[model samples]
Target: MRAIIQQFGPALESIALEHYTPASLSSSQIQLKMRFSTMNPSDLITISGAYRSRISLPFIPGFEGVGIVHQCNEQDSAFSIGDRVLPIGSAGAWQSYRNIDERWCFTVPNQLSDEQAATSYINPMTAWLMLSERLQIQQNMTVLINAANSAIGLMLVRMLNHLGIKPIAIVRRDNTLQEFEGCKLQRIININNRDDYHSLIKMKHHIKVDAILDCIGGGESLMLSSLLKEHGQFINYGLLSAQPIPPQFWLERPDINFSYFHLRQWIHSAEKIDIQNKLNEVMQLVYKGIADTKISARFSLKDIHSALNYIQTNEETKKGKILLTF
Candidate 1:
């Protein structure tokens, strides 16, 4: 079998696609033939040594993927040989085959196809948990989400709409304007890397949102933080701009409730049952086409470098994902 290994340093410096022999599966474990996976921002960030404290040396680097159980000992009633499952928790999905304990994987719903099932975990669960746990948003409350063109951002828009919370989108591309408009989203702020942040930030004068789900932190976060109503929720789940929050940011909006959500932390701390139950709920929403995703391209695992290059070139304009297959 072959796997992408991370031994040290940043991703470009650390990751390598290597062939290896697999150890025999244990009675308590199931051997899986990995089928599909996707490269996410979180995957790049971790491999780039952003979350160094949380990472261990020489580990695989992927959070979500689906696999077919090829060698099952019938230890778990929920899964058996030839079952399609997602190996949840921690990282190690960037491989051709895996020998994982039966308890760590969950059977994928028949409703989702291989492409959809591959992306079923990360974006869906992260958005759901933020709305269901951290934010105290009401149906009529106004919510603003940055990076509204990305996969997770698009999902957030739909999730908020389903909850009846008014969503104001801040996106980076103009091509997505018509797409969001088609959905009847009332407010869409389309800005570019060169535009003045203050000029585009006119939400405060028009309306005060109750909560802001910000993914692009940095100066973008600084300006957006000002638009939140007093004591509103400001949840920062990503740093797409590769910058930190300005030191004086908090002094300006001390009344705003600021918090960070890490799906990895939640996965490690929450009971397995809770994670499974939450994922099932999100899958049902996907089945209803409420939380669907798009795909821009698919690549074999061997062409990982080419895939990364494509992601960088089309990131600002691309509305879909880059998938990897064995």
Candidate 2:
């Protein structure tokens, strides 16, 4: 089996392509031939020692992907050989093949294509959980999403729209605005400059959103708080700037309900049944096209470095995910 191994530290330098014999199936295990895995920010960031405390070394780093079941050891399992599934559990999606427990494997609906199924877990599930569980968002309420053109960001946009809620998209470039051309977004605010606070003020004048979904957590996060209503839900799901939201951010707006959401945390603690059920709901949403993202490009597993470089340099034009095809 061929896999992208992360044995050392700090992204591309320590990571390398390696071939090894496949490990035997353990108890309740199912073997899968991987089809496609996304180059998610979480996957890339983890290699940079972001979650070193919880994640062990010499580990595989992909969090979400799709594959066909090649072997299922359990006779009573819902999955069968030839079933296309998202064999999720541990982070090993970067490999051409993976051995995972049957419980963690989710069968992909026939309605979704292989590429769509590859991205099934992370963004769609997170978006659903946030809107339906974490934030007490209601119909007709307006919400602002920074980095709104991102994969998960787009999910939130479409899901919010489907639920009859207005979405205000905050993107960094004018070309990024093209991502929202077909969507019926309430407003699209392009922050061309670091000092572009006037556009924010104009949006505030029109409507103080009930919640704000912040992905870039630095000066921009603090600036966006002005658009949220008093005691509104201010959820931070990503730190794109690699800068933490300081203590003063809460002190400045004590009434704003600040919260940090990590999908890994929820998956670790939630009941297995609940996880399966929620994933099923997310799949249904994807089937209905309520949660959808464009595939910007794809790369072979050996070209991992090039894929990383592409995502880095093409952020302005990246309306969707760049997959790593196995």
Give per-residue CA lDDT, model 2, range 131-157, as digits (tens).
Answer: 887889676887888888777788888
Candidate 1 regions off by >4 Å?
Answer: 9-13, 173-175, 192-202, 316-318
Top-scoring candidate (lDDT): 2
- Candidate 2 regions exceeding 4 Å error are 193-196, 202-206
* Collision count for each candidate, in order: 0, 0
Task: Provide the global lDDT of candidate 2 against the true structure.
Answer: 0.80
Minimum summed lDDT over a 10-residue window in model 2 is located at 1-10
Q: After superposition, how far is residue 289 of candidate 2 from its true place, in Å?
A: 2.4
Each model's C-alpha lDDT?
Answer: 0.79, 0.80
Best by TM-score: 2
- Kindly list the per-residue Cα lDDT of model 1 for residues 183-290, writing each as its tens digit: 547667776734534555665787787888988889888888888888888999988788988876798998889998888788878887888898898888788776
Clashing pairs in 2: none
Error of 2 at 310 (Å): 2.5
